[model samples]
Target chain A: MRYLLTIVADGMPEPEKLAVLQRECPRWVHEMDGRGVRLLGRELDPPEATTTVRVRHGETLVTDGPFAETKEFMAGLDIIECANLDDAIEVAASHPVSWYTAIEVRPFAGDLHLGEAAAAFARGDACGEPFLLVTWMGGTPATPVHDQAVADEGDGWRRDLDRRGLHVLGDALGRPDTATTVRVRDGSTLLADGPFVQGEDFIASIDVVRCQDRQEAVELAASHPVARHHAIEVRPFCNE
Target chain B: MTVKPDVRQAVDAAFRNEWGRVVATLIHRTGDWDLAEECAQEAFAEALRRWPSDGVPHRPGAWLTTVARNRAIDRLRRSERGLQLHEQIGREAMLDDITGGSTPVARAREIEDDRLRLLFTCCHPALSLECRVALTLRSVAGLSTAEIARAFLVPEATMAKRLTRSKAKITAAGIPFRVPPAHVLPERIDGVLAVLYLTFNEGYSATSGAELIRTRLCDEAIRLARALHELMADEPEVTGALALMLLHHSRRHARVGPDGELVTLEEQDRDRWDCAEIEEGQGLVEEALHESRVGPYQLQAAIAACHAGAAAIHDTDWAEIAGLYALLEDQCPSPVVRLNRAVAVAMGGDIDAGLAMVEALTSDPRLERYYLLEATRADLLRRSGALGRAQAAYARAIPLAPTDVERRFLERRLAEVRATGADESGPRPS
Candidate 1:
């Protein structure tokens, strides 16, 4: 995971804090370099030079300064890719500039080209590429197609995924013969049984398919339906 | 061919300058203090063996650290224990994406944290004060247990047990390795300064060595004091301790002879004294005094300043020294302080009063085994024209003395009393 450490150094005399950084940054950079870790660092101009723009309803709106007004302003940042949040935090916490400035560490969003809605789903896949897994869940219809029970069938699907270089993230048994769902709109609410909204068949459990994109995810989800009329919902989870 | 003395001196200098840095950097890379120290030592041994043939490397500290790191990694891959440690570290290494990012200063500082943590761990309160002092001298100051024991006038076995008990207590209590917070810094400073002072005193007047002074111990104590000052300059007591040490150490060059015999304070050539150290010590003392908070060290510095300020023995302000000793006695109240006060009193021409005070200390239990008490008493007796009694007192002191230098000084005094043949009962003329 990549962390963006936004250095916020407000209220400190600019020159004094800058001098500290000047003396400390070279040492810090050399230490990290010795460890074979390279980081991207940038110093931003003053807050007065900052501008924000947004296009909404086919109109462009420009603001005079940053997106938010706060006492601690972002003066600079370093992009560090580390093993986990812990490692990222360790690096950021030890930065020489951290003594005077606050380091706001946020994990970099993956799939930068994707819009917010799509990115949320795609980002998890992007982050979890190394450890992605595919499997199926839920009980089969009451037919004598195979001797294995629904739970056993799920285990079989997991074994098959494992054979294909995929691993099971998690699995759970569906609730015994009952399920509940709820929907809310405006100030009103609705509740139903049989998997909500009088669906043709109940979704006893969910199959979280690990794939690289929506097409692969849809394809994986298609092969796991318990009944002919049943439907599956595809969602994403991150391993990073 | 034998290695040139200059080459040996150069290598020794390199080791003194870079030992800590090399150990620190290696510890960062290796993540083990004991292993890092061993690895650094191995690298130095290799340098000693090869530098004579291949010549010394430029940037020797960096070269040594890099060589040690690589050797540690190679050794780790070769041994089962090393393999296990490597596996544990390798998991983290595999996931580390921000490589080559930290600076040498940061790495050195990180390694120094280990040393600081070792100091605190060695000084944990579960151990007795003796154990804490011994272990701190051994682990933090890097002195041997034998050296520490000699400094404290204890048997080597006793010191070894003290160190073992300290380490056991630390293990039992599981003291976390860290620098103490500001709240506990005073206590930590107290422990560190006590060890430094003891180490310096041992060097100033060695216990059993043929030589009167151990310059190695003196240099090590000075280095440790400097390190403490660097680490905690804001603490007034640290500055006071440094000032006290510097003032006393400024007289080192004038304290001995070419034949390695001790020189009495009055006979020491004032011109041979270190002027730079005297000036720096004065500056430190002034700064510490400005804080206006009096402590034992500040009192000692004041006393030392009295001596350093004098151009000759006659010009020494013994009265001011006596006053500072009195203040120090109130602040610390040790028998040693009172003994020092008597010396000042004698120098100020109250010889009879000083003799009375030294006589009274004979009954003090804390000083019963102390040779200095008898030695001081003999000086008073010699001054009062009691030659027979003074010679006998000197004889009593010789057996109790720990060092050859002290024994030699006592022998000389005894010979002086024998040669004088003055009236044994009456006070002598000044």
Candidate 2:
């Protein structure tokens, strides 16, 4: 369970105590975060720096003091994940803030109104999303049998994609042995017989597939038998 | 209004043997120190209440374990932490092997292993030395806060607060409740062994009090060391340390005379020594030496073995013992080790060599106030026929001696030197 702990304190604390807190609290925060207990925390500006704006019936009314007149104000806040309420209390009690101030803990509901795209992204659901998979193969010479195996593996992947109704469009390019690079510099055209950059591997194929999300595309690419000895890079298409 | 004597004895015995196990079992299952300790204590309290009328259970440890475990389960079920416990238990699958289709014997073994792990956790090197001692006494020895405070001569509230801080740090720092891995074993074992040795020494020769030995503290240290040796049978130093303590303790029966005067090793009655303990300690020393990788503790054990194995002081192999002390000094150099080496060298018939070593130690500020330094020098001087210097050294040491027994011993040596007329004409080193 996750809880937000609001550190409530009166006006300003003693400077010596504050100095001690400044030196030690951040270390505690880092330690708690390392333990995976604390998710995030931040110190808020003091009450004097607070600016409160009230929006009533679309009319904005600005005020000096942050909230209502109360005995204490929120000085800082921490979001922590714990076992449950008791565990959350335990974590909260360990905080240095609790030494001199109150730690108000409450359950965190998270943001519930994120739009469809963002919601899907948060859930890791790539439904109806498209991606491009760039298949890499060796530029090094291979036997005819190895070449045939690569072709057979690609075909098997295409068939599996078709069965899953995720196939969109894909193509196997000619070997890097037949590739060329063209460049124009200072109104002069230059040509090369191979890739411009020298590396052990080259792009051998490209696949455009529509799936639930990038996760599904990654799964499909990983399942491709060519990925056993080669590499498959799956990139989600950003349609803007 | 009266508690039955038999029931009280059973409860006390059970608490001594079963406290660590019961607390360990709960801590292993729950991962909550406070909860485990509280529930275990509650179980003991319940035992005290019911055992008289309800009759003692056939298997007291198991009964206590079951009752404490049930109490922990109840606490977990009602608290939010219970869900975390379940999740943790599920992930680790720690209880699965024992709880799922295991024999009663296997379950018993697992609980005993938990107690050993608990000791390691309590004596972890990450904790401060004082904290480690306090935690081990409380968790492993089943000493109450008041008892611990009284033992160490601290306030009860202070001891309680220290224990609370240590537990908080254990949880907050995520110190694991298990023995360290083999690679880190030596350093961690040093920490554990140091605690056990200190505990034993405090009991063997208490810093304060009229009594020379507190038998309970020595017993607890020996018990803990024996358990550690059992768990880490392959670690030679563990065996060495256990052997060293056992050998020293074997002579405890003869260490002090009937008049409560300090009995030097040469004057001690070998017939009063524990032959069984000497045999066990000698066996351990032999096995540890066979490992070939010697440590400080192993070297010290070998030295003790020479003393214990000998029938009399004349039969002792001082040369071999001196060689072992040299090896130990090389492994860990300290004034105490050097002093011991000097004594062994003198006993090995190299009196001048021992006198030279003690003279060199006179300039060391660390040992300036140490009474043993002066005492050892006094003995060496007396052996070399420098009776005047020996008497002066004994006078200096007698005032600096921490214990009454050691003071009396030094005074006796001073009287012997004066009576021999050697103090009248010998030149002083000054």
Candidate 3:
């Protein structure tokens, strides 16, 4: 199983704590990577530096600030492949931030390789790959004929992307209710079963694909087989 | 002036009926929600422009779908980007899929399935509860952003952002658009039903605001539930949910006094209840009960039916109502449900037992902020002839009441309790 380790703190840590994070984060990443567990890791810019983009009724709307506003600020994130949730918990606990702040380990809804698209980012090879997060929104129970069409038509689009190496990773997620949320608090590793975000229109499946730009991303998103009867969104990872 | 009034009316009606279908179909073919919505909106706009001159098409849904598909294709072809997306059209979806190309029965079945899929997607649990409500109203029910925003008391921009945020999350999270498979269908259907019920409740009693009722939201919820019942006729909970809404909505008129004071069910004028709605709701409750697959809504509807059937408050079967509530408590199990069951138990007979039940509930931290707990205790105390205790309970409840109308009602009860220091019956009926 793959889990996303989200490092968060109540606010900016003291400078000495920052120096400790800067000192420990790389060592932690190197160790995880040495173990072939870390697929990707990045220290994000602050929330103020974040930019939120949304396409509504075909119009691209851009706004300043993070995708969501909350008190606890996300400082960094890492994607790690683990044997099971217990192993993932051990890995999170090893991180220095877990002792002082908070580290949330959430599994991806599906298979993904964030490193696959590192070259295609808008900022070019200077930064990581800019992959469009193709989320397959909700769909109704498929009619017999519709399912056949998807098997016949949908796989073709995905395969073509794969053949060109544009498609990185994709798969359906476990049910949201099956989701397990983990947190390290007061020297205790607390575990709860639920997604981090409490939102409507949950994720059904996801695709990570390299796209030329937002227009191409939208176009590509529009072409998924399930996109016919369902909702789909094409967004870039923030670092992109 | 070229637009005939009838043509305009026809287009408006078709937009209401066919907008969801057209949009869903276009999105399926083109693989773009924006394109689908834009094309569907344009199709209606086109109909308003062309219907008078072209004569009203025999099949307005088919006509609208064809126009939307054509627009989607045109827009795709014209857009500078998307060589692959434009190539996506090469697969060539059957245009008649939206129109139900085969037999009439097949067409109706397919269209309904599409609507159901949209509903499930709109009500997916991944989205926040608010987003689920907003999306269902907007995407599935075809309410505009402005209208939905107004109904929810959010700014139009905020509603627009919410819709965009929801759609983005759907794609970002990969929420499938289909109805959940058999294994998860029970829970997913329950989720959909919850959204509609919550919507109805929000309108029936504005939880936070001063307004006692917001019928528009209640109407929207019923409209959606009615449609859901049609789509999933075999789902007893859907039928029960619809029945419950109808039964509760039936009392809208009598629920408030002439001066807009909130009236307790016992104090409401029974003659003012909408008889036609009660009859329809009662019929639905009967039909759902016949399924023998009782859920929370079925139990609730049964309790409401018990009340609706009675000619006078005193004539009502409180014991039966209490029994139904017990079933409901077993079904969902909430402090609020327990509170309601206590009221019914008191009405049935044993005041002391009911008071004990109510008294024990006070310790629950969850009910600490729930004003109804205090109010219920006050009512039971008053009934048991503990006027001073009842007065204190009522005064405590008045401050905790969420709305002014409810607060004023509590005040009235408090005054009545205070005035009647000594009564042989030992309590004043509110």
Model 1 chain B lowest lDDT segment of ten = B91-100
- For candidate 3, the chain B TM-score comes to 0.91
Question: Candidate 1 or 2, higher DockQ?
Answer: 2
Clashes of 3: 34
Candidate order by DockQ, decreasing, is: 3, 2, 1
**CAPRI class of candidate 3:** incorrect
lDDT string for model 1 (B27-108, tens) is 4444455565667778877878888888888877666766777667666656556356657467335213112456868755
Please list the Cα RMSD from the true structure of every candidate, rounded to 1 decimal place. Answer: 22.7, 22.4, 13.6
Question: Model 3 compared with the native: what TM-score?
Answer: 0.66
Residue lDDT tens for model 3, A106-219: 566545545435323312453324444434333343222354454346457767877776775555555444344456576655544344444543444555666666566656
DockQ of all candidate complexes:
0.01, 0.01, 0.04
The digit string of per-residue lDDT tens for model 3 on B93-113 reads: 444355445887787667677
Model 1 stretches with alpha carbons more than 4 Å out:
A1-240, B1-10, B24-31, B46-59, B82-87, B90-99, B111-115, B118-173, B207-213, B257-261, B384-392, B421-430
Interface RMSD of each: 24.0, 26.6, 8.6
Candidate 1, residues A53-170: lDDT per residue as tens digits? 3333333344455433556655654556565433444465566666654455444323111133223332333232321121222334334334235445555665575465443232
